[model samples]
Target: MGSEPGAGWEFARAAAVHSEVWVITRPRFEPLIAHALAAEPVLAPWIHPVYVDLPDWCLRLKKHHRDVYWYYPLWQRLAGQRALDLHREAPFDVAHHVTFASDWMPCGLTALPPTVPLVWGPVGGASYVPVPLLRWLGLRGAAAELARRTVTGACRRAIADRTARRAQLVVGLNDDVRRRFAGTAAVVVEPNAVVDPAARGSSGSSAPSRVRTAVFVGRLVSWKGTRLAVKALSHPAAANWKLEFIGAGPDQRWLEAEAARRGISDRVTCRGQLPREAVLAALDAADAMLFPSLHDSAPWVVAEACAAGLPVICVDLGGPPIFVRGTADGVSRVVDVGPGLPARLAVALRDSESVQRPTPSDRWSSARMPALLEAWYGQAAQFRAGRDAAGNGSSVSSEVGGLVPQTP
Candidate 1:
């Protein structure tokens, strides 16, 4: 129950504060959910878990990477049917698709009763690597990106379009996704990272040191731009900065080799995977986070870095920029993705060397999410009511006041 499933669980807990939550998930997670509920019995009554899975014969499709897409749609159909059956027994006011937070993916909740307002995403997947930056990724990575773009483009017009049109409110993970569904649906931008307030820690204590530590906390994947970070470390602009790589992947060897090749191996450290508490402790000690992910919708590390009051230096391309945007100057840097990205990243690294950490903001805090969810649910209901009043012909503006500001 980590990553996407963890996010779904958090949403259920948050929603349970206001209404009963029926959480539809895979059967494998039932034990984990039960354990979690046993620890916090108060939420047990409000959170109902409904396990849904495809037939045993279809399980093989889940084995392959590409085949999972085929399996997902089939699973959605089954989940939708199950939802329809449950609706007959107990009606729902709002249906939200939480996990698989991608705009191109179809949501089963769309099959809910038309009278029940649907909330789709804090989702993203519309962002892409710039052509020039694609060279940073190896040929295999580049081809994968191209294929993904093709698939996403086709799905956006077909499956995603239908889902967006069916949803009463579309909550985009970033502005790019909001723009993608802008004309077709009522869209609002919100990121998916929800940090615990207790995780907030003091930063900037290490800023004045002659040498600065920039940590990259994520899977060492090709598309994560770890190679670029390593290359930047060798640049004279970032001479004083050392990099720490957390998390593991196939790219670890390449990342290490690249650092050695660039003559900055001494300054680079690969810690592999660490516990969540250790990761937070690392964030508190580091001067900044260097997450130059090419097309990540919302990397949770960025929010965690913010919660630790650590500055973030990420590319202008995806949810990272959205998370760091409104902070005080020097608190974060969003480098543009194009030719000379490593050089530009080096400059950002140099610039972040002396900046004091910004105070942790409540923007991405979980404490604020319940109120935001309440507002989003209210807005979804209003949109549904307005559509019903206008014979399903009118479109309501997706704007709402007094909530956390939408992703800029």
Candidate 2:
């Protein structure tokens, strides 16, 4: 994975164990990757680290803003050059681009030789906050969503289209991307892997709380639907319950004021961003996860909340629903992102007691990712070799032969 110091590290680390991985990432991740390799001595030979220094302007720009999405193409350009250099020395098989985890951001590796099959994503770009939902957000919120869509559209151009055309296999975070890039190569959907296996076990079985407590564990961003979660508490069914927000963002003040305006401030607690352990602890104590994000592409919090055995209340769109299990059995609720969200969320909160925590499957767990990824790598390699043998091949959609579990 190209470095962003998040889920990409987990995927790269796990892939190292099963395949010869050359991580073309930023220099900042060097220390962490070194420590991880030192901890696992056997991975030392298999995983190769290649760091690329971003331009001074790029680095400064990225630091100044959260949506430095355009900077990624430049980063990938450097990575592509580095990858070509490395491939010449080692004669690599398949080239996989792991991050800048957006389908709209074309992988630089896709520009590699056609014989070197390219695997793109487990990324997302198709999901967005519906225009109808914008009214729920205030002026600033609406503007933010508009800006996001505008940028996303600007980014989805020739480069990304070409990258999609060249990929031997494209792994989408959810069906949104799969549908968007439908005619482009074989598309498979699998959300990001749950990296820490130790975090898999239940956060212990506990009796139902007399007063249900729902937790929202993402940045207090507009699209996260944090306000919707707070507004839901105003519903009579969920009025008795409290909402604990556990992250910080630009919209923190707005969320707080909204809660106050709704007269639910007494029940809402914003615990800012805490350490990983603290977040998990909060999830363990909460009865349900209120993650009604309008546009999310495989959020880690959903997996973490489920790992803690907390039922999730996510929207019926994007990646959250794909990850949330047992929707039929009430383990999770996928509410529509519209005017009725508060009421639907309230019902989910009321039924939180009956919601059953889903068992984490091996396919979705990070521990088994090495195996799953090895299979993908093998397939990608075989496809590359087969195409080379045939002299040439056309870019056409093909059946996803022998791919495991249809969804994450």
Candidate 3:
């Protein structure tokens, strides 16, 4: 399960239990959803899925890595029209734009009838990547990152502001996103809830191992900080620790070369990109998870690590801190990115046995997210109804209260 689609799939299933949800997504994903829904007879009845097909050129653009923004916005435009038609026929109380979970993306809900309260996000704004770390990426990589930030940040703020003003309630994936759009609307910060049954069942609640075998799982991207993890492993204190690298990307060769240069090639295992089950199995056998991601709003890997009862050694910044409970709480350790980071990581690895197996709280579990969303939908509906009443002297209390029809 990659990030957004996996999350959207989980959210729809979770939301369906308490409400009748009409999902608007790309036509490309309908088959996958249909297969899953058909397999689960109980959930099939509640969700009404509507696929918005983009033009062929836009769809082809989506196949490329960098052109998602081009296709996503165009698809949303079409979805807006489709939503308008649906609204005229059935008059929904709350309209939610769930996927493309970026605060920067203009949501279809913002264009919907104001009487239909908009719930935009569970969205994430760009997370900051330290420039000092980017120096490791060389001149070309550093320049590309700088350029991406400059362009994307400007566009994100402009569009985000537009969505904020119209949304009755905006759900942010982290405090950064909440702060970015706070005053414009009711902002609530919540991390994405991961619902990996395999991870949960496999935890078995075993104690942390004394022989430390740390694992880093994620794409071998520049910001993933695989280099940082490698640097920490090279320290004399971490000579005894073994690390398994999962996932593949451009950085694999660099990591391999770095590991060889550090003379710890034998200790490091680059497993490449494995299946989700394989990754979880690897995590199950490991003592700690090393995820020093430079920038991320809310990463699913951190959630998976926590769910598997694996203590994670991640940076103090971004979504990692929210997932890792830290050594003080006997779950994991959060380290600051600076001169002593490598030493700190070595120490954490050395003391892995002291850290207890962490059980992800209900707050981070999928079971709780739907209930939270249900409450938020209800609140947004009430806010919209109140505004409408004040403006037009018309009452819509009945429809407002049942924004999500109860599953009898």
Clashes of each: 0, 1, 2
Which of the two candidates, 1 or 3, achieves a greater lDDT against the reference?
Answer: 1
Write one digit per residue (lDDT tens) for candidate 1, span 81-142.
77777766676767888878878877887777777788888789999988988888899999
Candidate 3: list runs displaced more than 4 Å: 61-63, 196-211, 326-329, 359-363, 396-408
Instruction: Give the lDDT ranking, best first.
Output: 1, 3, 2
Q: Number of the top candidate by lDDT?
A: 1
| lDDT on C-alpha atoms for all candidate structures | 0.80, 0.72, 0.73
Tens-digit lDDT track of model 2 for 1-408: 212355666766667665567777777777977988899888788677777867777676666455355566677777777777766666566677766677886577754577677778777878887888887677988997798788777776656677888877888888898888888778888887463423445553445656667899888887888878878888988975888989899889988898899888899989898988887777777777888888888887786665555678888878888877522334777886666878999988787665555553333566767776777777777886687668766432322111111000
Residue-level lDDT tens digits of model 3 in 70-105: 766776777888887877766777877667778787
- Give the Cα-based TM-score of candidate 1 against the true structure: 0.90
Better of 2 and 3 by lDDT: 3
